[model samples]
Target: MFYNREIYKILPEKAEEFCDFFEQYIMPVQIKNGSKLVGKWLTESRDEVMVIWEYPSIEEYRKIIERVSNDQIGRKHQEQLKKNQPYLIKTEQFLTKRDKPERSNQNITVSGYIVNDVGEMLLVRTYWRSDTWELPGGGVEDGETLDHALCREIFEETGIIVKLFGITGVYSNGETIAIIFRGKRTGGELRTSEETKEVGFFPVDPVNLSTYVKRGKFIPRVLDAMNGQYIPYEAFQVRPYKLVKRYDGEI
Candidate 1:
């Protein structure tokens, strides 16, 4: 895990000067404290500049802040700044560990309701099960965050990187926790994932509805998430209790 921060400013010319100071002074401090300089950029408008940095240890960020507060160069930079507010921001102390990342215990399954502007849901006929249309999403990985994984999955499954809005509902089926995040169509050529045979968006059509529900199971809860005004829950079972079957048949 890493601690990251962004500093935004309005002056483009000052951005170069700031980057110079950061590279010459701040970056050395960061390297000494075991941190990496991620990115530093000035926008095309020449009015906005942004800087990002990451630290393997949150303690490193704290130490940098402490050193910045006491350093003569830091004080001089502060006095030289024309902006009234902070052109340089400080983190209010945060901790992170790779073995157990922040929000590692947050029970979440990365899933999304792929919907178009007309409220139609995007469904994929997956090769994994058969001819059926289901919303694109899957289980979150152990080392990945829910939001990031969901976005990647949606792109991989539907060939579209939809902008995920806010959390619509949290669904749990006792076995798995599903985080239903809202989404809108961005821009991407439609394609199918390895699990999906056919992928496209369709309205609430009943003719194709039969294919979605197999073995008397309704999967429309994914759509309920996009309709808005759906009830939010921390945990929910989309299906009833079931027992697993073991086969002793010949291999």
Candidate 2:
């Protein structure tokens, strides 16, 4: 349920004064009230500033913004801003959340950790998982073998017809299965489909991978593959994972 907002403000000539005020008074109050200032940048002209905010939920974001708006210190800061440079203009806002998990009666899924000749790995932004990125591949379709499914998913997602060089790892927990494959791009033009919005190769340490992987759940497997350590198939089938309940009886 995480959310984000991008705020763009155009200010007057005394932008340094506003920046100082923001850093000193506004940012502290926002953080204190539970809104994280994810990123911020200002122009040399001192006429505009762009800021990004992250919050667990819209309600939480509103609570923090309201608290800032109503604070005595915040009011004083706003007054000073108005007097010094009143041309502040807010441009837009954006909000997003994690994509819903894909469900299927058939439990097996075939995923790939495709690597290019330069050692970069491939990732995709799927239409189904809008605003989030993922390793390229998807469900094992009916009558499709695992290797075939892997090839099909890669082509469908990234338009790269590939030969499945080998299996990187296999993951299963009785209810779901994830078979990771390593492949070399064979032949095909990069194209888009209804399911994929974009696809490209990225270095193992991708700069923006956090937007897709909210937790560390799928990271270790990718890391292992990137390090040339192949995960044993038996390990996937043997790990014992169970759900636990807290003392309050809520899962």
TM-score of each: 0.45, 0.46
Task: Return the lDDT, model 2, position 115.
Answer: 71
Please state the error at residue 87 of candidate 2 in Å. Answer: 54
The candidate maximizing lDDT is 2
Candidate 2 per-residue lDDT, tens place, 1-251, comes to 34455444665565776678678876766664446667888877667787777764555566667877876766876776676544565565665643665334335777887777787777777543445566777656445567777788788767898766556667776556777866667678777664566778776564455655444657755765555544322211224754321111111
Q: Which regions in candidate 2 have their CA more than 4 angstroms from the true location?
A: 1-106, 206-215, 231-251
The TM-score, computed over Cα atoms with residue i paired to residue i, of candidate 2 is: 0.46
lDDT of 2: 0.64
> Cα RMSD for candidate 2?
16.5
